[model samples]
Target: MSPYSHDFETLEDSLFAMNIMILISMALPLLNVLGYFLR
Candidate 1:
């Protein structure tokens, strides 16, 4: 069995990936806030 045969992925590549995910998760709220303020 080769290591590549059962490859698993992780979200521990870089702090940037974590930060980006956080940013993405918050995008909806941020947009909602903007819409609320604009309205």
Candidate 2:
């Protein structure tokens, strides 16, 4: 396998992780608001 491909895979993994973090960050506040309203 090529070194460039390996680097690209690592970059993709990091981006995926960042996306998950961003999604969770966005979701938490919404969840909190939902819980507050539901309560």
Full-model lDDT, candidate 1? 0.75
User: For model 1, how does the per-residue alpha-carbon lDDT over 1-28 read when each residue is reduced to its tens digit?
Assistant: 6665445333345566889989988898
Across 1-39, the per-residue lDDT of candidate 2 in tens digits comes to 999999999999999999999999999999999999999
Score residue 24 of candidate 1 by CA lDDT. 89
Off by over 4 Å in 1: 1-22
Worst 10-residue stretch by lDDT in candidate 1? 4-13
Stretches of candidate 2 exceeding 4 Å from the true structure: none
lDDT, candidate 2, at 38: 100
Give the lDDT of residue 16 in candidate 2. 100
